[model samples]
Target: MQRIFITGTAGFIGFHLARLLLDEGFTVAGFDGMTDYYDVRLKQRRHQMLLQSPGFRATEAILEDRDALDGAIDAFAPDVIIHLAAQAGVRYSLENPRAYIDANVVGSFNVMEAARRQGVAHLMMASTSSVYGAETAMPYVETQKADTQMTIYAATKKATESMGHAYAHLYDLPTTMFRFFTVYGPWGRPDMALYKFVDAILDGRPIDIYNHGEMYRDFTYVGDLVRGIRLLMDAVPVRPADPADIAPGDSLSPVAPHRVVNIGNSTSVRLLDFVEAIEEVLGVKAQRNLMAMQPGDVPATWADASLLQSLTGYRPQTDLRDGVQRFVDWYRAYKDSGGLR
Candidate 1:
């Protein structure tokens, strides 16, 4: 069995991805800080579920602690490393810019150093659609220029991409950066819109609808997003022999074994339509609190995942209504079990 070291197994994406990989018969070593960004109970619950699998082992520690991170990675000595832990919230970054710099910048450097030392076959890290800041083009593609990141969170992720490219170029490390769209489904983050919308609607409270419910998002389901990551794990980039050898539409760097891929549903759904799906699933009309867009938030986002498809031969096809229903079902069950009140 191939051994894999994954950071942030307690996080929403990391939890789901670890489970999927474990089911596929991979040995996974998870690292997480279990921070109280949302609810530590929720994070603990995710880790507990993963522990049921004998293939899963975890260390509870923050990424900023280089010793802890290096210790875990050295002991595991994984064949591949997936760095997913980061201070993740666009709006929160506006409040605490230093947090992003610490976790995303400094902590990421630690991961890269570990990967370089371990000489892992591949290193995959998470980026976000937010990196496509200030771009109004339809269906954002991987090869597009994305320098204008409006939020600290997006800027930090962009910085990581640059850092990863430099490391790959220097060390010949095969690195892949996945630019994820708005992901949703069971075990989603509490700070996300879907979670907040469901919580407030079910409680008969007003739900905040930013951008007056006019925003558009390529809300890739959590399952689909993780599946994309799994497939891309095998689609590792290699340093191109020549700049012209890189395929058209490919984001591969000519000088390094590095590339950026967008994992998304590829279909943009209106914010109101998404809420309607939730309302329909819950059978409750939400008290809408329409408001102006939040700072550092884009009015719309869409992903052109053609590169992902050409590489992995898979695309995210989960319907918004179906995904919403699944989340609502999970939310209700979780609440009934006293996981949340």
Candidate 2:
């Protein structure tokens, strides 16, 4: 079995990815900060479950601590290094910009440096659709300019893409950055839309409908998101000879063995319709407290995932209703157990 070093194994996406890898017979060395960014018990539960598999080993440490992080990477000597740990929330970033800088920016540097030293075959990191802020084009493509980031969280994630490029250029380390588009599903984060909506609807509380219920998102499920990452791990980019030869809409750098691909459902789901799906699953109606869009939030986001399909031969196929139902099932079980809300 191949050894994989995954940062943030305790996080939402990381938890799902680590479980998938372990089930596939890969030995995973999980590094997590176990930060209070969310419920630490939930993170602990994720780790606890993973520990049941003999192939999984976990290390608890913050990504910003370069020395400890480097030690863990060297100790594990993984075949691939996946950096998914970060201060993950668009709204939270507005309240605490420093967290993004510390976690997303500085923390990413430590992961890349370790990957460079270990000479890992593949290095994959998380980018976000928020990086595509303010782009009016339908179906945000991989080749679009992502400089106009609306939130500090997005700006930092976009920075990691650049950071990975420079390292790949310098060391020829194969790197792929995946931009997520509103990922939602089982084992999802509490701060995400699906979780919040589910909680409010089930509790008979009013759900906050941002953008006054006019927003649209390309809601990709967590299972689909992790599968895309797994496929991309094997689809590492090779440095091209001429920058001009780079394919149109390709986020590949001219002189680096690095590329950025959007991982999302190609279809966009409106916020109100998304709420309806949750209600259907819970068999309850939500009291909508419609509100204007928040600062640094865009009205909509959609992804053109053809590049992902061409490279991975797969696309996120889970329908919105099905995904929402799966999430509700998980949520209800957790609520019943008093383990999740």
Candidate 3:
């Protein structure tokens, strides 16, 4: 059986990815900090579910805790390593910039070190479309100027892409960094837009609408997001034979086995339409407290996912309404399970 070592297994994306791996008969070794950035109970619940699968084994440690992570990887001896843990959130980074450095910057460096030491077949990690920064580009392609990052979180993620590339060059580690665009669905992070909107709408509270409801996002469902990741696990890059063949904005290190791919729905939906999806599911109109754009926030993010299809023959296909309804169903069940007191 192929073995996979994944970080952030307790987080939303990690939990989903780990479950998918387990079902596919891959023996998964999971590591997670289980930070109380959101609800510890939710993270715990996700972990609880994964434990029921016999092939899944978990070790807990902070990614920045290099020594602990090293020990865990040594024990797991995985064929592949997926680094998904990071201090996530653009606004949160502004509130606590040091957290980004500790978790994202130092943390990712630790993951790269582990992957290099293990000499894994491939190392994959999650990046955000926020790295696109303030580019007025309509659809973000793999080969585009991403040097301009607006938020500390985006900057750190962009930094990791560079760091991963460097590691790939130095150690010949095959690496793929996926830039995800607004991933959403059931079991999503509570701090994300969909969850917060669902909770507020259900509780009859006002939901914050950024950019005065003028924002646009390539809202990809979590299942499609995970499938794209699974396909990418096998799309490892070979170091380029010639630097001149590297396309523009490809984020390919001429000397390394590294490339960046955009995994998104490839369709940008208006913010009001997303809110309407939630309202439609809940049968209630949100008390929209429309406001100005927040600092370090972008007005729109769209992905050019043709590269993902070309590489993996996959594209994220979940529609907003269907995805939102699934989330609502999960939310109701989660509440019924005594999530809310």
Report the lDDT of model 3 for residue 309: 87
Candidate 2 minimal-lDDT segment of 10 residues:
332-341
Off by over 4 Å in 3: 244-251
Tens-digit lDDT string for candidate 2 (1-341): 28899999988899999989888888899999999988899998888888888999999999899889999999999999999999989999989999999999999999999998889999999999999888898899988777899999999999999899899999999999999999999888898888988888778899999888999999999999999998888888999988889877677888899999999999988899998888888889999999988999999999999999988899998999999989888888987888833
lDDT of residue 141 for candidate 2:
91
Cα-based TM-score, every candidate: 0.99, 0.97, 0.97
The sequence of per-residue lDDT tens digits that candidate 3 reaches over residues 270-322 is: 99999988888889989999999999989999999988888888989888899
Residue pairs clashing in model 1 are none
At residue 5, what lDDT does model 2 achieve? 93
Model 1 C-alpha lDDT per residue in residues 1-341, reported as the tens digit of each score: 28999999999999999999999999999999998889999999999999999999999999999999999999999999999999999999989999999999999999999999999999999999999999988789988889899999999999999999999999999999999999999999999999999999878899999999999999999999999999999999999988999999999999999999999999888999998888898889999999999999998899999999999999999999999988988988898998842
Q: Which 10 consecutive residues of model 3 have the lowest summed lDDT? A: 245-254
Q: What's model 1's lDDT at 250?
A: 98
TM-score of candidate 3 versus the correct structure, residues matched by position: 0.97
- Model 3 Cα displacement at 338 (Å)? 1.2
Give the better candidate number (2 or 3) by lDDT: 3
Instruction: State which candidate has the highest lDDT.
Output: 1
